[model samples]
Target chain A: MTESWLRLAPGFFALGALAAWELAVRGFGVPVYILPGPIAIVAAFLTDPGGLGGSLLATLTVTLTALVTSAVLGAALAMAMAASRLARAAILPWAVVLQVTPIVAIAPLVIIWVGDPFASLVVCATIVAFFPVFANTATGLAAGAPEYFDLFRLYGASHRDTLLLLRVPVALPYFLAGLRISGGLALVGAVVAEFVTGSGGFASGLAYRILESGYRLEVARMFAALVLLSLAGIVINLALGAFGAAVLRARDGP
Target chain B: MLDIVSVERRFARGVVALEDVTLRLEEGNFLALLGPSGCGKSTLLRLIAGLDRPDGGRLTWDRGRAPAAGEIGFVFQDATLLPWASAADNVFLPLRLRHVSRAEAMPAVHDALARVGLAGFESARPRELSGGMRMRVSIARALVTRPLLLLMDEPFAALDEFTRHGLQADLVALWREIGCTIVFVTHSIYEAAFVAQRVVLMTPRPGRIFREIVSTLTPGPDLRLDPGYATLVTSISKTMAAVLAPA
Candidate 1:
């Protein structure tokens, strides 16, 4: 019962915060144009369900594609880097540079150069998501005990067999951890790129809706879009977290 | 048969681990390399196992023939069982690496596990077993390959006394049954005397064999607590002490 109460505490706190927010806005007679209450935002969400739904679908497509590309390419790069010391030394610096450079600063330039806002946003998101997976996986590949390596050598295991049978399995947990962190970063990168690029018909997303509502002074609609974006980020984080935990549990066994 | 004449090993950092180490082993004989820490006993075993090359001198097998791949099985200090594999899979690893199918190797795997008294634990993962049981799995894996020579580097040093004693007996029984050449390494004089037919004691740092004592104790399950066992242990310990003493 105590454990159950502990689990519900966070939900109760969030409910209390929402109630306080609604009461504060109503009691102060705050202007709805500036900041809409939860009820008004919910009404706006209901009224323009189709438009909001379309934008969400667009954003999700871009984010998921970017995330998948980042994971696959990052894992490949990590494997390549682990296989060759020279490759690691040469490519690691550029990966760091891409990771540290703000997506906001490069989104407009990417859009201008690529001539396609959708592709540019995906590239930006992928850039944001690639580093953690690469770095974490590299570290994990190098993390196995020395005795294990000696055993592999004693068995006359080929380099490919060692990598596939031992190194990759050991590195999976680290890669998943990196993916969990990267999932949220990928979403943020896509939205930030969309905001900067100013989505048109072919590249419209939730960020474009947010920018549209702001310009038209529709506070409730802006809140609705913001809520949707936040929810997307939460879902991505939760999904990746569950995936990582599941892999660990399965490997650990019953 | 294996022969070593004046073998010497020097690390890149100029620390000599082994110097002028000469030894010869007959086929089907059990030998133990006994020494203090940092005495290069492991380096010596590695040299024989072809894991390391001597900086000076020669090592040769009888008839100038090298053993085939997987002919020498090694058990390290730790069990070193692959954490992800079941005990049966781990035992079958050597055969599998040699491209033997699981079906072809299953009987040998079962016999090896049975020899190590782990018959019912074929499907148990390494993590599910205790430390001693894991070591048994490692032994089973080594023995399953049916190697001509078994090299063990203090395989039981980490286990408690009861488990270590039990494994020592199991190992002797297995050796007798298989009639394979065995070279065991250990820092424990008592363990060396208890398990090996001949114990080779070495001096500290830049290790060279200081004494070779052959035991007359018959190979049996209950030879450890025999009255002669204590005398053998004392003789080996005294030799070890003399070797480790000041020059």
Candidate 2:
């Protein structure tokens, strides 16, 4: 019985916090422009559900595309690095520069160069999401036991055979860990890129909606869009977590 | 059957691992490389298995050509199984690397597992097994390829005495059944004496063979209980102590 209640505790706490915010906003008679109450945000959400939903769908598409592209590219580059010391030495510094430099600083140039709003946003997000997968997979590919390497040599396994049979299995947990971090970064990248491009006059996705609502003094609508954005991040993290857990459990056995 | 001809291995800073080491192995003979830690027994084993190249000298096999990949088997001090894979999958690794399908390799895999006394454990993972059972899986994987020579580097040093004794007997039985040449490296004088027909004693710090003893015990119910076994162990210990003492 206590366990069941404990499971519901987070939900209850969230409801209580929401009720307190609503009561405080109404009790203090704060202007909606300054701070909209929960009721007002819900009312704003009901006003334009289609618009909010459309923006959310747009953001999600960019996020997923960026994540998938980074995952493939990052893993391939890591494999190349594993194969050769020269490639690692040549490529790592540039990858580090791209990662450390701000996406905001890069987004404008990307939009100008790419000349396609959606594609530029994706490129920006891909920059944000690529490093974790590459760095983690590189570490994992080298983490196999020395004994296993000798065993492979004794068997006369080719480079491809050793990679597929030994290194890949050994590096799986590390790859999944990188994937989880990159999932969250992908979302952050998409929204930040959208914000930069939104000001450049591409009026698509939730970040644009947030900026437009703020200028128009539609504070409740701004809060509604913000809430959807937060919810999207939460859902993405939880989904990635579930997927990683399932993969590791399968590998670890019954 | 292999020959280690004047093999010399030197590490960085000129630290010698093996010095002027030469030995001849006959077909179907079980040889024990008996030595203390850092005596380069493992290094010698690696050279024999073609995992390491000697700085000087060569390994000449009976076949004129060098052993092909998967032609020689090895078991380490630790049972190194792929923790995520099933026992069957681990055993099938050698064959699978050759592009044999699981269905095609299942018979050899099963036969190897059964030979190791781990029959019906095909689906168990490494973590799910006991220490001895995991070692059994390692042995099964090594034997699945039917290698001509088996090189073991203290393969049972980590197990308990009870498990060690049991596996030792099983190993001898398997050796007799397969009739392959085995070079077993161990620090334990008694293990070397019990398991091998010929014991090659080595000295540490620039490892070189100091003594060689050959004595064969007939397989029978009373082999371990025979009075000669204890005498053999005692005499080998004396020889090892003399090597450690000053001239």
Q: TM-scores for chain B, in order?
A: 0.97, 0.97
- Candidates' RMSD to native: 2.1, 2.3
Candidate 2 — which pairs collide? none
**Against the unseen true structure, what C-alpha lDDT does each candidate score?**
0.88, 0.90
TM-score leader: 1
Candidate 1 ranges beyond 4 A from true positions? A200-203, A248-254
Best by DockQ: 2
Q: lDDT of model 1 at residue B200?
A: 93
lDDT tens digits by residue: candidate 2, A182-237: 98899999999999988674577899999989999999999999999999999988
TM-score of 1: 0.94
